[model samples]
Target: MAEKRDYYEVLGVGKDASDDDIKKSYRKLARQYHPDVNKAADAEQKFKEVKEAYDVLSDNQKRATYDRYGHVDPNQGFGGGGGGAGDFGGFGDIFDMFFGGGGGRRDPNAPQRGNDLQYTMTIEFKEAVFGKETDIQIPRTETCDTCSGSGAKPGTKPETCTICHGSGQQEVVQNTPFGRIVNRRACTNCSGTGKVIKEKCGTCHGAGKVKKQRKIHVRIPAGVDEGAQIRLSGEGESGVRGGPAGDLYIVIRVKSHEFFERDGDDIYCEVPLTFAQAALGDEIEIPTLTEKVKLKIPAGTQTGTYFRLKGKGVPRLRGYGQGDQHVKVTVVTPTKLSDEQKELLRQFSGTEGEATPQEHHETIFEKMKKAFRGE
Candidate 1:
């Protein structure tokens, strides 16, 4: 097998591209490489590549994993196939786009998946740098225990709808000038359920589900940035009529650190240095994500100079290796000085061919007098 291309490269998008940008790029590529439309020999292969790339990039968790790991296994999360062209009504929409209308209507009576839920979770900066497990309380719909999602009273089953004969649909014919038009819509009597509950479930009021507070434990991956999302499959609301449950999305918000800031996987912090330390090289301890490490500041190092400490930053979320920590040097100036200290600094300035503090003050006074006298 050939080595796969990078997902971002395949979709012609940057690694930091937004979700909408990725979607637009994938759609354009998919339309161009669609086998039925392109008719080229390699169109099918290109289409598959586009689909696979979109499948990984469009999902937050998969994209994060792929970004850190370089490649993702097909069986990990891409196996079920829920994104890209397949998600846009599959080939039916493609055929409709080229050949014109024939898209089928979804069956209203079919078991519908539960609605996905979103929750914003705030964590400490350190917790985001190093992964942590925590629990959250969320209110979601759960299947009622009394009726077991049947929506009927205990010991009593739902009856077939009399209006549509339990088909969950009704057909109507209209006489028009063009011809007789036949149409099918959901059965009004049973609301497309094909059944009617004579006695509603006492616990859920015939809805077959009830809202309750649930405590869900979430394992947050390391190196998660602000606005990063963690997906919990089948942890959302319970489905209707025994359908599959939806997903729960945990949106992460990392609190700001007093000394450190994060950029992607890297950590950044500013370290203060004295003028003497900048002029004469000195070894100082700097704070990393985990601990303090010794950093050597070279002689004559200027303010705003950045020093990189490799493998001392946040760990990759799911891949090997760690990001580097950048320390920015900020030279501090003394606000007050003793007479002896000032005299030593003046003597040092005389050797360097610069004016002493008293000589500089006299020069400035003479300039002000000359300017005042227009000389």
Candidate 2:
């Protein structure tokens, strides 16, 4: 690769320029060289160069390192800054300031990656449990079949820009404390593209791309939770001038289930039991992620007791095996009893010890009294 261009010279602003001045100048140049309006051959290279320049001068730490070492390669960690990790943070602000908002206007000659697309998918509860395959249709940009993304008419090629002489840049010299500083700005006449298209492509109108509907297939892995994102590389919008395509992200939304609630990979459900069943131990069937399982309730089983069924919940999202499902007990009392049943219960209650009744009723009263006292 050729030696990289100087950071100060790339943005066309002076080395001592303030942050606001650099930003303002970059925005102006970006608009001027933007591929949509300017059809120069070197427009894309100029855009990347400006972006790289802003990537460095905007940050305090990176800018300090560059100022001290006079354009030390930050990627090499020569002066003080760390490797590429430091480089991206500086650019992250730039991306947010520009592309982070609503989409910018489209340019035909610009070498831009296709626009990213998002699709919302609703998965059935059962499918969320076991995972499933699905297909979707997305409307996006594709390389123009007729012009092949060149945006120029067939049999015609772009000519060298008369203004910039193919360098796509113009340099201006200014006096500074260090010495005379030379700055690089995108050639105003060529709009940064060293070349200009004489006869535009008829099909794409020199856009080099076209809009079309495409079908994409996605496989959802098992145990995907709500709001999970799946990325489809190179499936987004088409790029201009043979640029790489953008990515497609699928966001999943899980529908609510009638009987179950999820806690991470674990499934929970409440099982109801009649008084008779609670008094006399019985084997009851409960629902699991895969199938039904049997749970045995011991005699005199109390309400709210939880039972764990190992490996019966959802599959682990990050690890192997499945989570344990919990079954909570809720004892049901009869609202109305038959005359004979009422008499039998009264007789049984009479035989029951007074101490048992006092223990239950007194405990509740004490709690109520404490609550009344604002305990």
Candidate 3:
């Protein structure tokens, strides 16, 4: 005894075959196995198998029945009616079914919000810290006054679309072997607006909007950093169909300073110190954000000494009180030497006392002391 082949295998398709897939496979197998085209002994048998598979799979009810109960007898079951094998005229037909008309459609006459706009503003470092208020001119669209936001003329009015019956859309239907399908698309007569203007406004040329410059006042707050955004309400482009206007966003760009580097709210800077002032105690003047302040240097101060000045940095953006300023001192080496100065330095070195550097700068100091003692 021989086993029966699956219907999906006969049509060369998966178990979940679509109508188009079954139709295509049936056409190809029918042309290949027909007695007029093929002379093989099994050609007639193969053609019958392909026809039976397509007839069962192409119908939704029959396919569901076959899936629920496997290998149902076609002669005694529901949806058993089959088309003749020579029904080639209906090969290119397609059908789609849609329920609840106008459920997913958008009305052309509905109000819509305007688009938001963005602008970049560059300011100096001091300006960002102190903040300022200024006015700016921006060109944007505005509603026309001639037709009062309508695209029609002053006396005449807009007419409803005749093609789509003022619905702004049209339905397309296609007939297939199983049933019919309907597709909804935008209408072409009135450009989906559902309204046609025979006579256009003179000022806006039927657009219902005009291009004009608007002056807006902006106030920048203190302690604003780079990439900060300030929003202005109702300052964007005009909306269509009497909708509300959008917002305007202003992005900030802070300029760099030549003498100072900022890290968050803290300020960092390097100051130069003379060799005499670093070795011996001295009080020097240092520049702060506001005024010059006096900073004391210890007698044994080495290079790269850091000093902090309270309440001298930039103001905090989100809290109370100001940040501190960090100052780093770099000792300047003397490039030129006088003859008398060199002799005095040599005599001082020959009779110098045993004074070592700080622990952090004690590199090679102990070795030099051992070499001097000959130990």
Structure candidate 1, residue pairs in collision: none
Which candidate order results from sorting by lDDT in descending order? 1, 3, 2
Q: Number of clashes in every candidate structure?
A: 0, 11, 1
**Which 10-residue window in model 2 sums to the lowest lDDT?**
350-359
TM-score quality measure for candidate 1: 0.63
lDDT of 1 by residue, 176-241 (tens): 321233456788999887898999999988888989999999999888889999999999998876
lDDT string, candidate 2, 142-196, tens digits: 8988878767789987777777677676666554221233445677876776767
Model 1, runs deviating above 4 Å: 1-108, 176-183, 349-375
Better of 2 and 3 by lDDT: 3
Which residue ranges in model 2 land beyond 4 Å of their true spot? 1-115, 169-191, 348-375
Residue 318 displacement (Å), model 2: 3.3
lDDT of 3 by residue, 10-74 (tens): 88989877788888887787667754458999997776666566777777887877777767556
- Give the winner by TM-score: 1 or 3: 3
